[model samples]
Target chain A: MSKQKTEHRKMLNATQGLKNVMGRHFLAIEQAYRDGKPTAWATSGSPVELLYAMDIQPILPENSATISAAQKYSRDFIEIAEAEGFSYDLCSYFKTNVGAVISNADLTKGGTGKPTFMLSTDVICDTHVNWFEVQAERLKVPHYTLDIPHVVSNTNNRQYNYFKKYIAEQLYSFLDFIQEVTGNEYNEERAKQVTQNSWDLSMVWQDIYELRKAVPCPMSTRDTFGGLFPLFTMPGLKEPIKLYKRMYREAKTRVDNGIGALEKEEFRLMFEGIPFWYNLKFFGMLERWNSIIVYEPYTYAFSKYMNPKVTKEMVLSQPIEAMSELMLSFWYIYDLKTRIKKFEETVREWKIDGVLLHENLSCRPNSCGLYDLKRHLMDDYDIPCLVISSDMNDPRKMNETQVINQIESFIEILRKRKKK
Target chain B: MQKIGIFDSGVETPEEIVMAAGFTPYRFFGDPTLQPDRANEHIPPTHCIWTRNLLEQAIKGLDENIVGIIGTHGCDRTNREFDIWIECLNLDFMFFLNSPRKRDNLALNFFINDLKELILRLEEVFNIEITPGKLKDAIIITNKIRKLLKDISDYRKKLVLKGSEFHELVKNAQYQDKNQVLENLEKKSEELKSRAPFSEKNIKKILLTGSEIDDTEFIKYLESLGFHIVIDDLGVGTKYFWNLVDENLEPIEALAKYHLTKPINSIKYPSYERFNVLQKLIEDYKVDGVINIAQKFCEPVLYDHPYLNKKFKELEIPYLFIEATYNRESYNQLSTRFSAFAEII
Candidate 1:
């Protein structure tokens, strides 16, 4: 057999704008650091709108970890953190950030500069609050943790109301903390506008996702991985809205032209965990087997709002309440039945033929239900499913050759099933 | 009485509520002896062995008397494991209580609301109403057990109880009927108070902290090495019986306040209080060193190690970190490490 190199497929044209978005984001943080502006390192799922309204520049170390992993610098950073008594069993993203922070790595290599304060929420996972606490202590910065209750099931009205009220109260406390830290007045109109902007951006993101349901998916997981970046890091800003609007148009154009991410989209796969950041080319390698990952809960999570009917009135008049909803709206935090239903719906809607479940060792919450999820989908739909075990950011755990073999076998199985 | 299996480390499960609902609150620590072959198929091997062992036990039908399971949102593993059990097992009753990580009034209120929801579910499923009066009675019984356990734990400061013996008592307390456990604990506490304290001049005092440690053998081994366990912050240890429920308050509200204000595990936020609590214990017990023992792949405790290490360093306290699976594959290595840690302290 002749040797063949994996081809790197180009992502959506609008993704070009992401470079500028990322540049401006890091630059703003740099300026904040240099100019001694009020800044806080916030978790990706935190209420960045509140931070933005308070004129506190929110730096996302999670996003920085992602950037470091993509740059193949996470391994060294992770080792540095591991040497600092952080167990290798912990989250790779967190370790990478800790490593970068400890080593004082440069911006290009994912060093999140010290901030005046730190903020995190346990809305997504239990790891967030503790992880941020570690950094806050290390950096000698005061940290605030927002306790957002998990929405196990939305059907329980009284229970959900309590959860909402609890979260709203926490958000109010969060505002007080920010004000106390920054000595800045709470700008109600700016908070409202920021919330509105995030909502509008999420709506456009939802539209972009809808366009992915096209027979030949206009956008692939590889693109959405990058596309979801600004949405996470700069959610309350207008930049994401502009970028996502352009992405919607580009994806719409692709769908209109019947252009898929691949030359031949033979199989559509749904990925169930975070992508392997160090080897994103693995997504491209799947194209060699005539497969395109059109759906991933991990990617869509940035745009998946549990409460879509959050009104403008609610956003304006009750900004904290609206922020509470946004914080509680993460899909992964919901119950198993609801998440399974959404998974099945996406499989049918996106025409997914196979599922790639990455049992990421670092993220217990995301990886825990995946085995059962795979079983349910396969049992119900008779679809092919393959589980890849590795860490999302830690390259040490991934065996490229073994993963290739597994993918080849899974692709063969999918091909045979399709032939039937 | 029938049993309601509790899957948390027992901090947020509120065994009193289970007793109020007319069931034994059987705290399910994954069997250390059992190999979780089936659970490995469901969750990856990277998951903590305690959760995997619990799932394996449930899958194998090892405990048929468990009428239901009360899983709490204490950690990510327990939270998701609750979801997994709901999907994979056919239980008569399953409740995932959303215990808050933060200790605030809102969390207290939310926890009360959640406990009430749990009470309603338990009532509907088991055909039993958990009246506040019944709950208050359960609190008294549990509070008595807590007092007895606290008395026994205090004796450890005097070296009156072996670490292994205390671990056994705590472990057995979660499995047996609350009334029976209370009886046993009362007798044990009396025996401990009457017994002569251990008088070893060279015994090194050590504080234990981290994940739910079910391995009594490990504790026994540590004690055998001439190190006295002064206090523990483990979920199955002090965190289980640290705080007394305010019997003066409403039953559910008291339960909520008790669990929230207790010495929280590594998963809870505002970890300074937890550290401070441990520090206070260290000072009170005159602990020579600290040993944080976490189950391999346990996230919460492992995440807290760096911070804990920093605190220990600042106080010029010697600290040793150990990550062990349920299986004992490295006893010799651990003994060597512990011996070295002991000598330095």
Candidate 2:
């Protein structure tokens, strides 16, 4: 019997800076826990700027789950949750967080201690509320669900103001909930500063994405997946801005120097769903075949707020409404037609050769309508799409050898089509 | 009369509003027997089977008389299906309603405004006025059906009729016109009240909770295993008519209040409220044990499983979790699990 060796690539220089930033984040969480400062464990998509303004340390359990999966400890944590009655088919991210919590694992192990409160948002999906509610009930802490109504249609903008107001009102209620939990007065000045920082950071994030369009793309999907940590966890603070600014400079330099994430960039591919956290190295296999994933909707989705064109002054003047707008601007929350149009735009702009759709079994919101997307891409846009079935955080669902064979076959098809 | 299609689990599409708009509100429950080829093109196999079935039915043409369809932000699967239908289904009209997850004044206010917007859209699309008087009359007719259904719900305690029989009748009512359904329910409630009560001694009165089990035959099979489901927290069953809309308030406000204040569903937030409602039902029904059966890939119910398991244990209630799908093989699979579960309890 022969075993295939897993190859690791040194992708980017900015990776070291991300590690430093994440290490500091972990230490700060630990310090907050030890000092008895109020901390709130939140969903990755929730409005954490409010928590920061209120002096409450915000901990993102989703990012922590990603960290655990990358470290190869997610399967153990997942089994712990299943043994405690979480179904095997539920979102692995939620289960991993629950398992880590039940075992009293801390920040170092991709978990956080019992916090003063928990917060969730329906901006991404209804699963966030469901997952957080359970943790809040078990820990006997106050939980708040910020519901952002889905803008399901492009022509449904007649109710745009109402949607904005609905979310704004919920933001006020969330503020009250935070105040009650921490006994901290709502600080307007601090909120303004934080909102400004977040808006500024997103602009820089967009610039970084633009830089990925260079010939011989300077960053791979694997690098961006890790680089997105601080953007998701601490975007409301100033430190991420400095780090992101540094990353932008680094990518710009790479682009100017004609450097790439791979030795030879053959095909520019796009990824549609969440990457397999357990097997991020799988991306390296594509690189070995001289195919580099230049764009990912999952990563670009975090910066969709730039589309609606909100100025920094607007964000500072009405921080709550700004937060509401940011939560509501996710492109995935809209109609399938709109999403496909956006996907088509990216395929054209990035000059994509093929599309890879990860049909993650555990995430319905992200995986649901992907089959149609594949049809649209192939039939309408003339772009080849390959769907690889797996779970984002559950390695048990993946057959690596089978996936490798499928990718190799897909790349062969793309090569043939390119020759044609 | 023209028809307006509705989805299960969310109360945003009040039958009264659809009726006031001069349309029959026909709820869609995906069939468990049909194989889906076209729906698989739009939705993956990993989604809720109930949704896939619904999409299959829609593609097959729901009804020539279906003037429009009303979709709601019910769950993630159904929520996205709203978009898919708009793109795929060539219906004349479609409307999506956004329901609030939290039960508070602000949420209520938001929901009321949303309902008002829906009413306006219905009126504009049909080119007819939905007068307040028509809304009140529609509310009265729908409320009568709910009251009769509640009355008939009591007959389950006697074990006179099988749980599947009652659910089948209610499921059929959703497809019929309101007046016809109300009349049939009134007659059925009267007939059940006069029937002789059963004296079965050893039947386990089970409380079924979770997402909608579109197939009542599954319930029948459980009953065949000596476990009789006397009550349920299913969206299509009791929760559909659990609360009546207030007649005194303005129609839109009443609709908003009823939806937000009704028995919390699985997808709602602070999931403890759902457990609280189930706890009360367990006590009221004298439930021997709970069979938590949810559709495969139904995130709301799956996410609540661990917390619910803990709550049931703390309350010393015998609980079993079952993952159900629309496939015949899954039904057969459940039989063995049900048999062992029935024997253990």
Candidate 3:
């Protein structure tokens, strides 16, 4: 009898599982919408455990916009938003999300569904507040904003303490808002469980990323970028945990089997900022050149949970403070020094051969520091870095051939450096 | 003595403290002539042109005289500019004041704490003690300047002053010494009030809003096109001068309250406050149209545009939105649009 094909026989088995996880996640959201359950449009760094505990489905427009851009369907939605006076230079995710909402485009059929209310945090980017404001206006729903101040100094600074206090207060207020909107009592147990689940998933996700540091890194940027959907969409759920477990196992196996993401693995690269979601196939093209992007700071930044010691008991005891710390761990909340330290650590650990920084047109907070970061990485760490100008979703802002040429030239330089 | 530079939008800078700290408080305005090539090298091209221009000015405009620069967190672009300047500039001191967007007890507490931190840092950096008496004296001088500015703006609404002249007065106030600015405004106000109220039969009164409007040429162009900018909600215009710190309260807390209660801008939340302010301006000025002069790639202003458009439509107000840069070449299209808007109203 022929030997049965094992599930992990193919390199893409874990990635395929991630896709299924995302599919089911979206289907559940769609089912929730169909069932007349109130859903919310939440910022990626917003306190989502509250929504999950309240049984309110949280749909992240950023994630959905990424999906739309990946599917090459964001242009029409963006144009619609522009027609409504949204600037093309604004965050493309905003344009795509607002455009999709105004046009009544079934984003879930494509990626997400219309939100009944909007909840956003002011932690990651100023764009989140403005984007959700426009979305709430367009959808004619109530909008809630959680102001999470950036920690300007070390974790122990007075500013950080005040920020924690402010965020905790806001988180409690947010819970009250959720309760009022959903007409449901606050579920302390459920919220704790959700936070605990988030902590579990974060550990597994970090474990998977740590596995990529192995010689001949086991995962590709494309796989990790695609795998981020479940984490972004359903972080406090079993689906993402299961998906991450599978990913971790596959990466571990790849390390043990001495298999690299690329056939020859000539160069290991670190990609900064968001990729051009419209053309993820470009990542696959890099493999042909024997270069693999083993490190993407955005994935690691988003997947990192603040405290590993967080237990269900701790979460139940102080859900607001717990949620505040969780949201505060968002990479954008860090000051320049801490942020730079994190980047340097990632580069050292991943043994990054070169850095490709995307000067994303739509994202200011993420892209604004690329030039400064590139300068530091080059001058201080002696790491070669390149800044590629592109948009997160808008194809018009990118020249495909030029991007390819830049990447090829970068890869050639990396190869020459390695030879030296 | 070397001058301490401050961005025009540094409303919470406690300029008096800087003055007491033995440095001249020089408010840096955007030079329309400065090329943003150097800034573009540091910041992304998609950032606000106004901010890029400011960075260019910081890099080249104040070469030797600036001892330190105090930046504020008015918007994302401003925050990034502060980061770049702190990292790149070889200055004696550079500080960023992270002001909260909301106006609440917590926000005020944060603002006061930040202000106190700024004071302590200034004392440490410059080796100058900031006493309450010195702060009070500085507040008095700044308040006089603000009062004069308010007079000039109020005169503009009453048709006693031309829009270009009012902008020039405000621009001078931004750059000149507080005493010198007050003297000029006092003299200009007397001359303007003595003259006959200027009126044209068909000219439209337009209320300008959005980011900074420092282009004197653009103001002249609008006036030439038979439009009077009766009022504005710009960061560097009326919004900068209309609010004054309370003298009775502790100076630091008063400054915090002043910033928290300042006219709403696009960066702040519950943006209805901005709409309310704009509506009041429109009504007070009896404006014929509203002109939103936004810098391209300015997220805050761009985000507020759609809602403002809807609000204007609901209120039956004619609205003209124009995206601009700090270049003269870009004004032709703006001039044409303004002229068309003028005709329509």
Candidate 4:
């Protein structure tokens, strides 16, 4: 029995290390909050590098909501929010956070306390604009929004040039607002350093996701989902950099050793839209069927920051332009053509056998037109796609039996196709 | 000649550009009569009904006279469907006018540049020039229609027209050509002012706030229940005609300012602006209550629901929230809620 335990330990990879780091990070945040350190609630896609440069703690309610969902506590929080007139149709993440705040659920173990201020951007989705506004009002904190216009054309077009200028000016204004709230000067040098770190961190994440292209896929979908915490929470921090480095190293080793996440890998698949955070174990069940989700577009969406070649020198010299370009390049912020192009490239690169699209009921921007995208993929790329309707945070919206049945049937179809 | 259809949501594209390019500018306000079945093929079933209805219309080529369609960013639904529209519909010209959510200088400049880009694209597509003279003329026609509509709204506030009549008049104004709409509104304004005022005794004056509602049956039914909708903050009703483009400024700049600084809506940031607008509407219209007819999955309005409730509570104003679907099958539920709200007020 002791020898078996030792072998199991050897098989355990950086995912366990990642879990430990995340736990420690949350503990540190709780300690900071208890110490009355300055903290603010920030949107996941907001310009968080500025917060790092200013030495202000940034809390992401979405991240907390996701954690609560994974822990199966989102339903309680969601009910609380729904009781407060937040409809069940609203983003479950928003509902969960609002419910937790009103009910004092403390899903973050005191890590996410009352914020000093709130900040959000309109880059990824309008939900951020609405969600942060409601939170700021409820918490009685000053809220600031960065209105990053959508990129309507190609990057080289004149419209994009105007958009870049607009975003740069808004970034300066955002900096000014942050300075007023935090009583700190805009640290250009520190911001440049943070931006460089962000670029490096994003590159590592890109490599970590790209390494899954190996046959039998080095990492499982569940591990990748767990690995997203650092990227979402500590973008410019060294912790995520270290975490991803370890993950990449382990993934490479697994690839070399021909050790896939599943004992008998048969099918490689891609996931679309946000995962049902409450039922992420369902993804592990795929491993039972010898099927692995090698790619999820959500993880690769963060790779947008690594492109266009952002350097430390450019970050310092043209800080606003650099930041504006980074914000503008967010995958979800772009048009359908770009989204389709990226998905196609990922499908080709990962050699995806099938696709599982989540028709998340709560997210409009992410979930809308997914059926159309699926049809396009089927018709143009000859890729088989199946859509499952569920909410990422709200457990009530998901039927475990139904989801498992659909997934099983989908896998059966894929297997039959392979046999044919 | 095929017309260029302009979809709603405060589109900033100067309608004059299309007109000068020799294509008539037809505003598609979405047919409430259209079913959501066709649109569900392209968009999810849970999307905003107005978007779905419009997409259904586009899918069926309901108006074969339309050669192109222009979309604007007012909400998530509108913004996300732009690509789908181009791919799903057979149109030679398609463009989405990107607008910022704030009324700051930077946002205005971005809007102005965006309008300019739209003009350049229109020129390239239709092989026509959008001279300053043509733009000014377009602005003149649009402003005239706006002034007439404002007069009509003011008359409705004075109780010269009933809520149902006001809605019908606005609906007609939305679908007609600018010249015809202006001419009809001018004639109706004079006729309404000459009529006797509506009796205010024992009648509850309420304000309606929400997205575009093409089916006035529910609203008309509310009126039959003894509630008077004295003012509206709906996208299609008041928000569309409340502000006019400045005829004195540069055509593009005026259009940009008009689009940017218009009465606040749910999609805009800083809920305080929208709250302030509602507060002023409540006081100015002497509204006894507010009925927020929000769409079920509409995130922007749902997010603003709590804020609206808080403000109404502080103001000691009675308010009711009703979530509506495109099918309008839940009229009984709405009727019960409206009756209770009427009793409270």
Candidate 5:
């Protein structure tokens, strides 16, 4: 087991290096997409394209937020927002967006320019619609929310009608607002092309994840997380497709060669929480400890991971579900329990000995029911579990000593089990 | 319609809530120093001890009488908690207050209005009518108690009564009848220390905040660590008691006054006056550390933790965010952090 673990670590490290190179490529693509000021309007899959049509630099608030919690941000922003009266805990991303972007009038210093508008593609949580709506009211900043369909039964009609009646018309209004703000005409053809491109990449990323299911996984979660950068930083585009294909090919070669990504693969760990910010070197934990963490929650969020085998015609037929199903849309159907069950299955199939759940304080989605997950892991698999409480990004919010203490104790528990 | 139970610590519980619904307003005023050793075994030591105490009371059936609980995002720890806890323990709960940022007066005004909206929302959720008459009656009950405590405090200053008399008077004010407030102060136990009169034991005149150092060991730890620990304003210290009104003023106005008069210590104290009062205490008593002990997820402090850190940093005074959980296992580390800090005091 130890030798196999070493092999897994070696494989994950190499895969990580490849992903880092791929990340650089994705950044280059983002650089191309960058306009003046690097200012981004944080759109909640609710109605993001308005900013794109408006020429407002689009930055994923979830990206900054997760990274911020990983960085250990100015404490949990959701708490601050909740105290400010948005009391619903239905969506953490919404709470965070409001906390970090809207309420944090000082956020301008962090960015090159002011985030003029926040768009929401209200698909996952209904609370998000109210959240973005209320923020727009409070800040008096224009907020555009495109109601995406919630996939309760994999049916699109109810979702499509809901989109038309409550969301699509509002989306059109948002585009008009963008036109007024940026003076850029809405380019329908370009938008459709990017949408199609993103839809294709989604399928591709999903396929890559499926291939990674092989024992001594030819790819590492670290690689998948890193390589999915384009999807997050610049989703619905060409660069991500190119990047995923390259990584897929690289991993396929390793599998074909019958060489492990690591010379030895021992314990497999499944990671939760927005990846650690400063110590993004979180992957390094497995590297140093002779283990491999095979899957990450957020990386699978990309087009390819969630919507694999997506055909161009399939996406063209239902553009909204094509893009939204996995991102904004899927969360409702798969829900928290489904995701956890899937994570548990993945861990068992990967033959994981332990799980390192980062109980990120700020990420409501990740934090919700973590204690419950810890209980489940113990009762079901009798697997040793360690939960590190942390903020995803804001470095100021990280409690180094507390976290280090938890890690030491958790490791001790698992190690003690081995000695027995 | 079911009545919603609105409970808060210290004098922060509004006087008008009962009047709005015409139900008995149940208060949960606990002794700040009423040691809770049992809870220490269950929760982490770095979390809010006050909230831990509350949870202890709740889980232990001490607060089973209350129908529901309303919490605020005053700290990150408290903010993220409650829901998980209540579900696990099976208590009905909801979040009703907004975060208060007092940098701007308009923001503050907006904040008060937000609270007003929260009160109404609570009414709607609980299915009760908040009549003006009930508010006025509730105000009277709270005001009468506040005045009595003020009188006890004044008497203690003049040597007309001992400080223990006042502690006894204030500690049981929520449950005891108003006539008892004066009687409790008058019939205080004679546990006076002659070697060091009440003045000599001036309690190092410090403001102590930590996750439920309600355990005497934590208090004894602070004392053994060298600084005298005085007011527990933030945790299970002074803020755990609810005030009774005078049975006089308008209910809403009385509610406003109760929130206003609550001795403020950063966690949504009615006004900035609490900050001023805290500064005055630090200046007058030659106080040392503003140790903020927050339970993990005591939402109020998590929101206020950064600001308090900033203020203490700017003042160049000793302030520690002793974010311990229910039961802290790291005494060596805490001892090292505090002993070094105690040297400055």
Candidate 6:
């Protein structure tokens, strides 16, 4: 076999193994659900754990919102949120949240059934904590929102305190609710066994993010990222964890050799703002221009770190420490200063020539405050910056041709600067 | 020398920023009420509802007193989408911010540094000091206005006020005259405080989050539901006041302090200290529940809501989701959803 193909096969094998391990974890959870043993959701900052806490089988609005945004139905759903008293300029993610909730009008998480409750956290994003407030209020469901303080340095003390407090409270509450709803006592024996599976599932899933080590990326960024998809849907399930192991070992080798596929020596562009959904072609076309979008700073990137705060103290009356993607994502520690520094450093590190700031139509967060950032890039780095226009999910809001033309102009500026 | 004037976006005139700088701070509103030329029409046609609204507002009157204009990235549609104008239309200067929307000194330092950079470029290109003293004066003057306004708003919210009329105060407060505005506010506060507090019994306090839902009908709908939207995450409401200057600092230093200290509205930039702004709004208003309104194709909110929703769930505070559309025909359905959300909590 050729050197590239050999690498690819190794990557695939690793990913396949991880998936297998995750499968076992899922099987355990599914079996518990089928047996009607008892299940509950308590949340930490991570979606992975939240899935377990939310009972794993229920259609979570958080999971649904992101998927719906990617599906482009987020806007329609967001409109429902706005009508229900949400705001236009608040946050696009929240809008998609409305979209996810409204779009999933009837979607359930697990094939078995919708979970009994939703679990949440205020540690990651404030808008969402409130967004869940609206959801719980509307659903009239008894849910839990664990308030995690801002982990400025990503400390375990902070997370442990929060997790222990909320987990303890939630356990008592869950104990009461379970008795009232199912007339079951606090089933410690069953809960521990189930919680371990959930932890095993996350440990395996973490392998997916670590799987980018294969040269030419043995598996595609698509395959690697895709392997973790089950984490959202099948939290506490075995497949996600099982699938990650194979992928992990292959990635470990790749990382050892310093042979990852993101084209390590290229000018890594930190893409800001929403992609034109109408022009989902934006990604393809931009990539075609020799412009590599390093990270878009969405939830996709938010899932790249592990929680430093989960110290078995139990913040939400459940095993939040062992799960949840938020704590798992390195980006949770990603602050604006860090990001700006990263943007600058990455440009230096990745040999970036220019940055394409898509000033999205509806997302004020990414789109807002460009003059300052743009000015800094130009003055400090002497680099060219381009601020293009488009919507996050809808293309109807922009003129595609004009955008292309502007991008072309930006490319020219970048090339001109690069020549110097 | 012709000087360039940069200002934040939205409805209110940037007269204060302009006037205090000792140079004409032109109102560079993207809204059509102040149309300069067809600079933006090429990037996005006039058909876009937001573009059209901006053009209409700009056309009404964007003061052409300044030689150059600076726009914040916060204004979404018109600020960063200026390549069309810079390339095709030809303006003297157009600078956009690459600011991070979070309360951290780094961002503030970046902004002050950028302002200096902008000044340097403007000086090199247009020969303008927006100077240390002038910038300082601008900051001080701007602070005065903010303090005065904040005081009046606080006074209006004081529980013991008799027949307190905040709407009247908000309307009159926008007037350029500080003394007159203060006088009116004081008188209003006295009248309101003299009377007993309005019964909080049925008045549903709401925290609204979304786009520029400055429409009268939108506000009215909430009011009809017996909800008084006390605060919002809207640009015109919660977002604009997110940054503050640090004490024990020079005006320019203070300006820089705002960058790192401001609450981030963008989900693109990671802010673990998220919801600082929203939480403040909730506490200040004694908000019962929250309403997060998302615009048709916004991305930040898509990322923003989960964090907010997560918090609300933990707090057990009910929040509603409302998505916005330009399709006015859908108003009835929207109203029904609004009523349903309000009724839940």
Compare the candidates by DockQ and give the number of the best one. Answer: 2
Which digits, one per residue and each the tens of the lDDT, describe model 3 over residues B32-144?
A: 77788998888877777777887887776574778888887777656655777777678767777778877877778877877887788789788889988888888898898
Candidate 2 ranges with C-alpha deviation above 4 Å: A1-10, B10-12, B199-201
Per residue, candidate 4 scores C-alpha lDDT tens digits across B116-194 of: 8888877877788988898888878877877787778877678777777878777765555667777888889788767
TM-score of each: 0.95, 0.96, 0.94, 0.95, 0.52, 0.47
Between which residue pairs do clashes occur in model 3?
A107-A111, A107-A112, A108-A112
| Docking verdict class for candidate 2 | medium
lDDT of 2 by residue, A37-60 (tens): 999988877888888888898889
lDDT of 6 by residue, B1-345 (tens): 233444443322233334444454433323212332443333333223444444344334444544665655443333334332232323566554433333333334445554454455456555545665666655555555455445545542454321124433443333234445556656654665556665666766777775455444556556766777665555444343434444347655666554444455543234324476677777877877888776554434544565577777898888776666534455566877777776886
Candidate 5's displacement at residue B89, Å, is: 1.7
Clashes of each: 0, 0, 3, 0, 112, 172
For model 1, how does the per-residue alpha-carbon lDDT over B1-345 read when each residue is reduced to its tens digit?
678888775467788888888888888776667899999878888888888988898888847788898888767666667777876678878888888888888788888889888988889888888898999999999889888888889878888887889888888887899888988988887777679988777888889988888878888889889888878987667877878899999888888888888876677778656778888888888889999888888887888777788888999989998987787666656788888888898
Q: What is the lDDT of residue A13 in candidate 6?
A: 51
Question: Which order, best to worst by DockQ?
Answer: 2, 4, 1, 3, 6, 5
Q: What TM-score between 0 and 1 does chain B of candidate 2 receive? A: 0.96
What TM-score should be assigned to candidate 4?
A: 0.95
Candidate 4: count the clashes. 0
Error in Å for residue A254 of model 5: 5.9
DockQ of each two-chain model = 0.66, 0.71, 0.54, 0.69, 0.03, 0.04
CAPRI grade of model 4? medium
Share of true Cα-Cα contacts across chains kept by each model = 0.77, 0.80, 0.48, 0.79, 0.01, 0.00
Give stretches of model 4 more than 4 Å off: A1-12, A34-36, A107-111, A152-156, A306-317, B10-23, B199-201
Tell me chain A's TM-score in each of the predictions: 0.95, 0.95, 0.93, 0.93, 0.69, 0.62
Candidate 5 vs candidate 6: which has greater lDDT? 5
Candidate with the larger TM-score of 2 and 4: 2
Highest-TM-score candidate = 2
